[model samples]
Target: MNKNIVITGTSRGIGFELARLFADQGHQVIALSRNADPIRALDHPNLHPFATDLTNEQSLKEVTQQIKAQFEHIDILVHNAGALVNKPFEELTQADFQKVYQVNVFSVAQLTQLLLPAIPKGGHVVSISSMGGIQGSMKFPGLAAYSSSKGAIITLSELLAEEYKEQQIAFNVLALGAVQTEMLEEAFPGYQAPTTALQMAEYIYNFALTGQQYYNGKVLQVSSSTP
Candidate 1:
């Protein structure tokens, strides 16, 4: 079945690969990113690249408005855009925290809320979280802001699942382990992760296709012992 899928941060990394996979599978992909060149380079007819800064309220509003105008219902929404600020808790300022939250929390909340009208029953919402945000886990240094933002996403998804069950909308968060993406590399230099962006993208694409049928309000942790 051809589904309407919206993905964020499609300029590169896991989101980019996901867009490619979805388009290849014949689904309509609305790819949102600050830069649309990479998405446009895909040259997939099913891919519609929209350049919009997720952290900017006006930009998000315009994109969401355009989406609502064009699509009656969004079958899937993958919130893969995130910001990571690596600084010691004490070194991190209010502005730093706000910047991370703007992309990881506020913008996601805003976009999802605006797009809800276009998400009918059976719609699935998945946000990419991090293992750092997983509760009761080993804490990493210099990741307080990023981890907290992800934790908020997990909580938000759980709450949304319960609140919108009547509407049959499903919400989930994927707490990803270190994937060999720019974000991971930036956070952990000279470290080789056990997973690659393409691998993670494949995993997410499969889950987005049928996750609602079996899971909601679940935070699935994905990782391995070795690369």
Candidate 2:
């Protein structure tokens, strides 16, 4: 059956691929991103690309408003937007942490809260995290802000999952390993990751559709290896 889906960070990378995958499959997809041009260029009837700044509460609220105007219920919500500042802890400023957290954690919570009413009993909220955010996982340098923010969302999802369990809405986090995305290229120039954005998006797309049936509030590490 066709379902309504919302995805963030659709300007590029996994979010971009995921939006296309769902829309092409006849699902109603709301693709949110700072730069809406990429998704907009697709011009798919089922895909609605909205310009959104996840760090801004008003911006996120507006997205929910648009959603309410269009769909009766949301079957899936993917918090795929992220902010990464690859800098040493000593060099990282308070603003850097705030910016990263604002998008990676705060916005996820804000958007989810706003869209909660529109999400039906069996809705799935999937948060994208980094493997570096996982406890006991290998950590990298110059990612204190990015990695920490990712970790925060993982815990946030867990908490939300528990809080909303009775409502039957499943909240889960996917801690991803290195994927060869533009973000990775910009952060670790010249480094190659085994997985591509499309490959990872395929994984996320499948999980978002069916993973909730088996798990809720769980953090699944979706990764091949670390670089």
Candidate 3:
């Protein structure tokens, strides 16, 4: 069956891979990113690309308008656009933390709320979190801002799942670990990541296909060991 899916952060990395995988599987993919020109150049039949900055409310409003104009309903909504700032607590400024939260937490919730009307009763809402969100205060250090933002996402996902349980709209979080995306490289330069973008994409796709109510309201961890 074909699913109408809208995904953010589709310019590259995990979001790009996820969009390609879903489109290849005969699903309608509305790809959202800051750079729409590149996504438009793909010219895939199952793919529709729109450009918008997730952190900017005005840009997000324009993106939402486009989605409303194109599709009557969306079966899947993936919140994958996030920012990470990895610096020691002393080096991190309040502005830096606020910026990260704006991208990773605030915009995510705002976009989801705006698009909730378009999500059907049985649709899915997937928030891409991080292992750091679950583990909390990692020994790796220098990730306070990024980790906190992800932690907030996890909490938000749980609350959303509970709030929308009666409506039957599933809300779940994927706590990914060390995926080899541009974001990961930026967060931990010179470090070898554990997972690949394609692998993470496959995991997300399979999870979405299950369509099981049991997965709803849960934070499913996806790593090298998870299958």
Candidate 4:
């Protein structure tokens, strides 16, 4: 069955790949990104690109309204967008935290809330987190803001899963390790990762479609390396 799916951060990296993968599979995909050119270039009939600013509340509301008015039901919602700031803890400011959380945490919650009505029974909500977000996991120096924000979303998914369990709208979180994505390259130039964006997207694509049947409110650490 073709599904009405929504995904964020579709301009580049794993999110971009995920959008294309779903569309290629004959699913109706709404790809959200600040810049929609890349998605538009795909020219896939099943792909619908919408430029959206996740950090802005007004922007989110407008997007959700448009989404609800278009798609009668959203079968899958992938919160794949993230904001990262690579700065020492001492150098990070309150505003830095706010910026990261706004994109990584606040937007996820707001988007879900606004779109919840359009998600019917058997819908799945998958949040992309970081292995660093897992408590007691390997911590890095300049990722205090990024990791903590991911952690916040992880907990939020768990709670939402429990609250909406009766509706059969399963919510799950994936704490991923290092992936050689544009975001990673921008944050740590010249560094290489064992996993590529396409590789990770393939994993997420399968999980989003079928994992809900066996898991809800679960945070799976999908890591291939330490750190």
On lDDT, the leading prediction is: 4
Write the residue-wise lDDT of candidate 2 on 114-210 in tens digits.
Answer: 9999999999999999998998988889999998888889899999999999999999999998899999997789999999999999999999999
TM-score of each: 0.98, 0.98, 0.94, 0.98
Number of colliding residue pairs in model 1: 0
Candidate 4 clashes between residue pairs 3 or more apart in a chain or in different chains? none
Candidate closer to the true structure by TM-score (higher is better), 1 or 3: 1
* Runs in model 4 lying further than 4 Å from the true structure: none
Per-residue CA lDDT of model 3 for 145-217, tens digit only, reads 9888988999998899899988899999998888888887788787677778888888888777564356887
lDDT of 2 at 69: 95
The C-alpha stretches of model 1 lying farther than 4 A from their native spots are: none
lDDT of 4 by residue, 106-204 (tens): 999999999999999999999999998999998988989999999999999999999999999999999999899977876677889999999999999
